[model samples]
Target: MTHSERTSAQSTVDIAALPSVPKVLLHDHLDGGLRPATVLELAGECGYTALPAGTADGLATWFREAADSGSLERYLETFEHTVAVMQTPAGLERVARECAVDLADDGVVYAEVRFAPEQHLDRGLTLDEVVEHVLAGLRSGESQAQASGRRIRVGLLLTAMRHAARSREIAELAVRFRDRGVVGFDIAGAEAGNPPSRHLDAFEYMRDANAHFTIHAGEAFGLPSIHEAIAFCGTDRLGHGVRITDDIDLGPGGEARLGRLANYVRDKRIPLELCPSSNVQTGAVDALENHPFDLLARLRFRVTVNTDNRLMSDTSMSREMARLVETFGYGWPDLERFTINAMKSAFLPFDQRLAIIDDVIKPGYAVVMG
Candidate 1:
């Protein structure tokens, strides 16, 4: 087929078929992906009554509305109730398990879900215990997903809040569970006052241990944060690095000039976990149409789509992909390329990453395309 014909064929893909096309997610947050019914049940079990609504549907609406506040800090506030109920082993396990199952059902063949262990210590669980329970739940969830014939591999990325001082400790904890289901490390939270360089010790520890990590930068902040993450902390990937567009100059006649930072990011193939819906909800961009994902993708940057938070944004991997298609007219090839980008950038071992890309991702996309 000619190029135009191929493009026309690709554009004919039904958006409803998205859920069956395999995807890879690298920036999902565990605490932010809970099922509303599970949250209510867990809250009742844990005696945490601070939920803003009584029914599951009401609670879901509340979370979606609260997260739509257009401020990263306020968007984060919705986590208070989630973290409150997830204080016990059962809560953590159930949440982790459900997260795996939900992603699997959404056609995520491989994922690295992150959560801050320090925040789950409210009910006296130690850092180790928190990690252990979550790992166990993830393993169980993987088993359950397999039983349901939706195979998925979920890896844990232990996160430390950027505003907290326990990054070194959290880094150490991530390393401790590295051989288990845990795959990598990260720092996440509001990015206004807390720069990624503040957690240099943690990044250094990860580098020394030969482990992989991504930093939450360039979302709420700008190019400076992306520069620090790459030049200083040496992050393996960028979580929500949408703001890297600040360095690009779009000129007349379809010409684009890349400043040093943007050029370096493109040259290095640094994966940008661009969460379209969540970025808009957090005001990283005014709306999905204004997002720079298409520009970055066209520029050959290693851009990957992600669902940063499922419940808050009421999205899944398939939903995120569909939104991009609707807004940018992405074809099956574009979706396949994004999936390959995420699989390649995953913290999994090189051989394992390649295996999933070749065996699962490519074959699945081929079937969908055909």
Candidate 2:
């Protein structure tokens, strides 16, 4: 089917079929994707007694409810439990392996999973050791997926906590592992009070080393964070940039005008990693229907869908896409465009990105469209 033909014929999509379509995820957190069962098992192995629930189902419910508190700072507090259990190397490996397998099973063809190395140092493991184990698990999961007739390409994005002082160190670690599995660097945490400019040294270091990095901006804070990230830090992408809508003026007659910053963002083709469910959970948007995803898409911004924290939001790539379909009436062609946007905006080399867009993404979507 041609693009227009598919769009008209498949105006409505079956949410169940979303899992079989190819998807690309650019903004997923490693610590936030852990399985409830694995969290229980790891807590036990690590002798951590801080988990709120005894069983997997109960823990899952706890995480979902706790994260729904509607404050980004409170939402982040749930990570203390997950990070506590992941202090050991074995714990990190198991989480990373399962994360890869889960994403692959959900039909994600390419994913860049990120985690902060500084959060796992309580067990005496160095930064290098932390990254080594996670990489090993991802490789194992890739082989396992291939054996099961699934194809997935996983890359690591080493994240530094925005409130911490080890961003430069983490940036160095990301560069050191660039050839192994690390594709980029990031700074994540509460965006309030801890501005992206605080880590200028790390961003500069990445630039000097000719590395790629994205900043967690415009989620909790607003346009100032995004402006600093793009204009100052030179982030290749904006993580959860839903608030960029603030710079747009929507007229009563349905005309839209973009401010200087918003125009620059659209003009530069800067990708916005918009997470629907997570955005609602953290109170970034009033509700999913109120999300600016459709407005931004209609305005031709480089907006890509993502699952910021799967466990907290109880989301997968498939679920995120389905929510957009339900809320914005997106069809197969729209989903394909979002997937293509993510693949093109990936931190991988140009040739590799092009190869995946041609060989994996286009073919996979073609099958679904037919």
Candidate 3:
């Protein structure tokens, strides 16, 4: 077992029981969460002989180490191999299927996994074809999960590269596939030079169509990026809004004074998809212990925990919860609060979200808490 697994086992709470709790994930990257073994197999299939390790566990270690190198841009370099093999339909389908199965196994009842359609165009497939194949694979995986007594509903958030000019086109594609399982739209890339306002046209298109879209903001860059995502681009959620911590003023006795932007976010109840481990890996935080998740939650920032990249961060929703529990001394109720916060903040319809909360999340947590 991993050190994380052992740490969870030794915590005051039963870490082994975490997987049985239903989870809702809103910020996971489809490309960043590929299985190490799958990455090796996909690399082999594509004849892309550039992997750093011959074995899966070795590759996993390499990914974790490379991501911890104190540079977000360098951390994203690992996606080259995963995206390299995902150019073909078969590869995309298999990877998507595996993503769903893995999430279901980790007890994620609902998830909106994001991926850039523009990245998969190297193999003669259109953006539409990429979405179609991924949706098909998610369906297959969901069916398989249900057959195994785990009901998982997966949703897609079509992502455009922030540095690329395909944001508007991807937003249109997201609308075209909205009823077909694409739940929302997003723009994700390095936040330093590529601000969310660069995709203003895409956000405008989504807004005119009354579609939901989240922005990758308040991560590597600080509140300026987050301000653009919200005050300018109108993001429905702030993907990895960990950097919003910069706006908060904490007194010596633990009193928090919220800035205008932070107050706006809290008053609006805008969800902040806080990926603690990924934040640490991407240098958003020095370590998990230093993360502002508890503070934000205590201040009522609509904080929701997520695994931004499961493979790169070597994390899952269960693992994220366990780490938060270990760090902040949270219990079952706190975990359930995060789950419900994620569920409420989901881009799905109100009825569907409420049904999942009423039928799945609340009941499931009740059972676990009891």
Candidate 4:
């Protein structure tokens, strides 16, 4: 059979019916995926009176609608509520623990979740306390998942708010916890005016300390922000680097040519942590059909799928993969490739990364696609 015929045939397989596909998610948010019930309970526990709705499902719907408003500022308002309820150690631990269980049930074998430690300090906890709480929560969740027969291992990425100058301290915290649960560092929030280069000292310090870092770029922002993140700040991976599409041209009959940045990313296999629904909600793309995910995947760029904020975006790894299959007619190979991309780009040690890919990811996908 011809290559196109094989591709078409592979696209028709039933993904949901497949038995146990392993996944690696490198860009989930700890604060964003709090269970709706947990949110309500935390709000009550902390004595915070603001909520968009009453029921758990209704609260989730409120978050999705608020984030879907197509305005960056509006998209961010949902986080205000999620973060508000995450101030205390109890609330933070509960959310983080549940997040692991949920992701594991959704087929994620490994995950690196991030949240700004500074934002969790509203009730006067220090930065170290904030990190400790999250790490403790993750450890608790890991033990629970293991007990339930799910092989899930989670790592923490301490995100420093870009609008704030605490990146240096956050980087230090990440490096300090490198042997523990903290695997990497990140800078998030307001990417337009808050370039990653603004935290040059932090990135430089991380580099010197042999730490890994990713930057949230080209989501609500554009290519210039991505350029600065890679060229200036030296990001190991790019969060929502969908705007790199602006640097490519799809010529006639689906033949594509890459501009310099695109070429650099593709050639070097710089991982693009592309979250489709979040990109659409934030107006990074006009529609899912127009997303650069298919093109980037076709060109063999290191494109990994992620749910940037599960509650705010109301998405999962399965949902995102299903959307891509429906839109771009992706096959099992594409899904397997994306999973491998995330594994390779994970902040785990090189040997651990290989073990996941070789032992877990490969065997799991084979069973699903067999």
Candidate 2 stretches greater than 4 Å from native: 1-7
TM-score of 4: 0.96
Candidates arranged by TM-score, highest first = 1, 2, 3, 4
- What lDDT would each prediction earn against the true structure? 0.93, 0.94, 0.92, 0.88
Native-structure RMSD, model 2: 1.4
Candidate 1 pairs with clashing backbones: none
Q: After superposition, how far is residue 82 of candidate 3 from its true place, in Å?
A: 0.6
User: What's the CA RMSD for each of the models?
Assistant: 1.1, 1.4, 4.5, 2.0
What's the lDDT for candidate 1?
0.93
Worst 10 residues of 4 by lDDT: 10-19
What TM-score fits each model?
0.98, 0.98, 0.96, 0.96
Per-residue accuracy of model 2 over 62-179 as CA lDDT, tens digit each? 9999999999999999999999988887898889889889999999999999999999999899999999999998998888888898889999999999998999999999999999
Q: Across residues 211-266, which tens digit of lDDT does each residue of candidate 3 receive?
A: 99999998899999999999999999999999888889999999999999999999
Candidate 4's residue-wise lDDT over 1-370, tens digit each? 8887765665564767432678889999998898889999899999988898888999989999998987777888898889999999898888988998888888889999999998988899988888888888888888888899887999999999999989999999899988988999999988878888899999999999999999999888888999999999999999999989889888888888889998998888899999998889988888999898888888888999999889998888888888888898877877888999899999988999999999999888676554
Which stretches in model 1 have alpha-carbon errors above 4 Å? 1-7
Query: Which 10 residues in a row give candidate 3 its minimum summed lDDT?
Result: 4-13
